[model samples]
Target: MKSNRFHKQLCAFLVTAACMPQAHADAKKMWVQGSWVNIRQSADMNAKVIDHLSTNTPVFLIAQKDKSCEISWGISGHGYIPCKFLADQVLVFADVATENSSPEKAKNYSPTRAFWIAPSMRGLFNAGKYFQENLLKPEQLNLENGSVQDRPEPQRPPKLIRYSVPEFEAMKEMMNKGVIAPVVAFAPLFSCEQMQEAKRRQVGSSKDEFTRSSNDWSAPDAEKYPYSYIYAHDCLVPEIPKLSLPKIKVSYFKDVQKVLPGNTQIEEISAKFGIVERGSVTGSPRWALDYDTYRYTGAWDIGSYTLTLDKPVYEHVIGRTGLVAVYRWLPGIDEEPFGPSASCEEGLRNQRNGKELLSGYPKVKDALLWFQSATPLSFRTAKINSRAYLAPARSLKEGEEQRGIKKVVVYEVDLDGDGIADFVQWDMWGEPEISGPSPLLTLRQIFININGVWHPFERDSYGECT
Candidate 1:
């Protein structure tokens, strides 16, 4: 009898295990397309070829292996043709339903707009020239005895400088202001003593010791002071374009399980997450895509809950499972302006309340959900120390009541079945106190993943004020 019961339990466990859903497949089909630069009469020919392809010409992506892909040109004459191009051309895939079909026409695409080029490509081309010019040839020099011989000095190593955000911002401002004059004009007037001082300070070394210890100090006028104005001028300027922003690729994911409040706290959760208000109803959680991170937040009767993650969790809702990084979002308590003067003090205050709320509920592990970057520049997690002080909320006037959030959470997700997340969504919230039409929530920063590395999207120019 005991053996029969054990066998029955074992059968039940096996059945349950078999019924469990599997994780979503990561494999995805992507398209690769690019403009033809120079097409010749033959592969090896140097002859001129007519008919340059336009920048936004649509090309069908047949297959992608590693970084290269087989593409079919959409041109009337050209059929299936394979071309060697970088992986950056693989934009987000078509919607999942259309994945199996032929490539669709690209809309609102303009080729004249600048596209990002990978740094690896830049290094390949620039470093090749640098090697030939600086390393391959032997240096010809004249000795004090009037003898000319080929003498190549050892190559100077590259220097790396670490800079803070403020310092970088200052340097950019200076460069834009053109405070520094041309090296040709300024180098002649620059004192070697000042340069030596700067170098000594930078490296934490003294000049007297450096000069006495150096072996190349006895060379001819030019070679002895090889670190002169002409050399200094060349070293000061950088070869790459400083204005270019970091390149990042965005991926979207979809069909993830949505976490709704339990039956008890539905009303509070609705108000907290900006679902229902005085008379309006904000829609359910929508898809969103930012270059950097995925965020979701809503309030509950017990307290407000926020779930911030590095990647979207749409797959989990759709019965798929994968690892995801989680963070607690803590909103600020104080109302601040949307400018440079905004600080993290208000967010810190809100975090204190969040901590209390968390202590009350043992299940809550992640901390409060605070707006890191908003119109008013409320809180910057990167700028503030993790151990900074969190203030307590103060009492409000009799007439003043709590104002609900009027912002939306932006997300980047793969709405299409393609392995990459390309879709972006803005979840809007209504302002209960305001009488006018509902305002669309704006996203201040976007997270992007380019070539498996993550980066934050930065604004190129400041927006004009109305």
Candidate 2:
């Protein structure tokens, strides 16, 4: 079981208080009373760690059982916690306590998303905490989970951004209508298997979207259609217009082109990612972090970029080295990068890491919705079926992950009731790395979805799919 560093005296006192219980009218809101409380997957003491609600953190109540209650403070904070940790009312005014407020957000800290339009999901069954929050009090976290090992100073704490009930309700109403498969825009239905085949080819070519390389886009198709031969192999890269790095020289972009000019720096670069997170491609195979620290969206004060395929072709990276480049994926390529490539078997298995991650964030917040989009290819500027998915914007290739950033997903779905499809959205949020990985966090850029568009719900969301 995950243990806390603080004394259990507070817990004991709360237990005593719980016994003398107040009225059963059931509180409308509950605030975490201790330094922090863990949300569990099951009521059992040893079930699984879900998330932590900081002291004085408040959440709207869903249900109350014996000792634990289901609560969601909003965004990434949703799980079952011991009801004893909360009181009947909000402790602090949220306007003053939230660091995510527009005017209060820290310089280096921004929600991992560029946009967070409220979602329409209120009446939906079990629609996790898409939008929710409460006031909070922050304090240092010892992080002494097990054996005492010195973690470096400057530890990153979680951030809580509160959203208005109206924005959330508005978004919720839109989502209740439903989502449509983006593939509807494409001519042929591209299966996930076909998408995987395209990716395997990119690795074999040792070329990615950013890397300088070329490919034969022509492919044989089982059933030919008007757009059957819409071969694609390129997309709009970071080019020069999108970079907003810091002054520090990113090894990858140290002497590159306009992408990573001579001297570049991000206001704040995580000790993690090292080069992967840099706007410039500065990664070498041996030098890069293992399969875990795959680069997610990098959103700083300058604002984040939409990591999407410019057109209809799926995006792929030639993961041969750290300087990864996006690839215009062509299904049925039947090839892999010649040198430094992973077996298709390993690659396919890696995608499932998303499942493992959700269980890690055991509250199962913002599960997932994947589909194929008719993306445009840079090479021919032709549309083709591209594999795409909308997952929570956050990811965790490391542990002790900082929390609070919410991922926003603007998508189109056909409301079953409406018949014809229309565009609707939800500000997706969740984190897998909050508790880190069980066993131990590993090194590897485990691909859950393509880097740009499909992001985790919350920052640092990771889990062991194994």
Candidate 3:
């Protein structure tokens, strides 16, 4: 009787096991379309999340449901994911093109009224020649016996590559053929911010350092147009003319050199000051093919000067003097601006509550020190340290009261390593408070200890009108 009962139980167990649903033998692989897709335990909206999958994650489709489909979750078991989130193929971002399609394939592309070259074709031509030339070949000198040397090779300025109108039209037409499609369906994988970071990393490093390419296609291709990352991705598309081009020929003043004599030459400043942008002007027969626009931003230290010239004089300067080793007139250390005049001091006195918000934070201390060391003009631009001014709360909308962030408090920071608080700055924003439009209040000031009395020596603010 016992043996018969055991046999009956074994038979029941075998039947239940056989009835259980199993994964399909020929499961098809699908990629996760969106980032951070949830893999749920059951085919329900509120089902427990078993795992998470990121964009382009591969998964095997096991079973199909009404709204969700079961997928093999790693090695342990299967989980259900929404069918809408699964893609039959993976998408390609500009940051991740395994094979770089030739720019020449889009040879029929045309340039807009603002530019001479097809935007799509800018990456194929090297723009780094303007900057990299200074680093590659410095002034070559010929020497013989001591005190006897040949005149140094005349400095060759970086030259811009000129593309004709026909070439521009060809490239534009080629892109229209759909050899390469822009990744506009989703957010840009290689954002301007990412490109800036890549360029920053290449600074001071050798040309070989910048040449190092990643096999990982997901990385941003900063190498293509080292001077301009924007050209690498979006230059293919024509830009809408924002402002009408100047009708007259524009040129930089030769007096620009006279005003700023005794200039200090640097390896590269074009990234900061920028280079002359070349674009074609139609209906103006006087405008030559070699004409270019000059944005003399900080070129003469008299604010930013912009002019569109008929002659290629600016291009000649770039070609002859190279933007990389261009001469700059830097202000002397004594000439650096320090603030907190009587008026500024009077304004800051009304806002100072004398409260310390970030007393023991090491991160804030490190950041302040790093900020001071970042640039030659850091002390002049110390107002950047104030969070209250740089990052103000959004204005409350209609019918919305008690909007978050009521008051911001300023804290004392030790700018120098003297262990004494030398500067007063905004550290953080306040918690949510009763709000209509929150008052924009910010304070940034440095103090000098004179006879044990803290006197405001310098101050900086963005929009503290009072």
Total clashes for model 3: 27
lDDT of each: 0.24, 0.28, 0.31
| Per-residue alpha-carbon lDDT of candidate 2 for residues 21-72, written as tens digits (9 for 90 to 100) | 1322353665565433567887766769765444444466778789878765
On the 0 to 100 scale, the lDDT of residue 122 in model 2 is 12
> Which candidate do you rate higher for TM-score, 1 or 2?
2
Best-to-worst lDDT order: 3, 2, 1
lDDT of 3 by residue, 271-305 (tens): 11222222221211111111122111110111211
Q: Which candidate achieves the best lDDT against the true structure? A: 3
- On the 0 to 100 scale, the lDDT of residue 171 in model 1 is 21
Error of 1 at 60 (Å): 3.5
Q: Model 1 residue 14 lDDT?
A: 26
- Model 1 ranges off by over 4 Å: 1-37, 40-58, 61-71, 74-374, 377-466
The positional error of residue 110 in candidate 2, measured at the CA in angstroms, is 18
Output the lDDT of residue 3, model 3: 37
**Error of model 2, residue 45, in angstroms:** 56
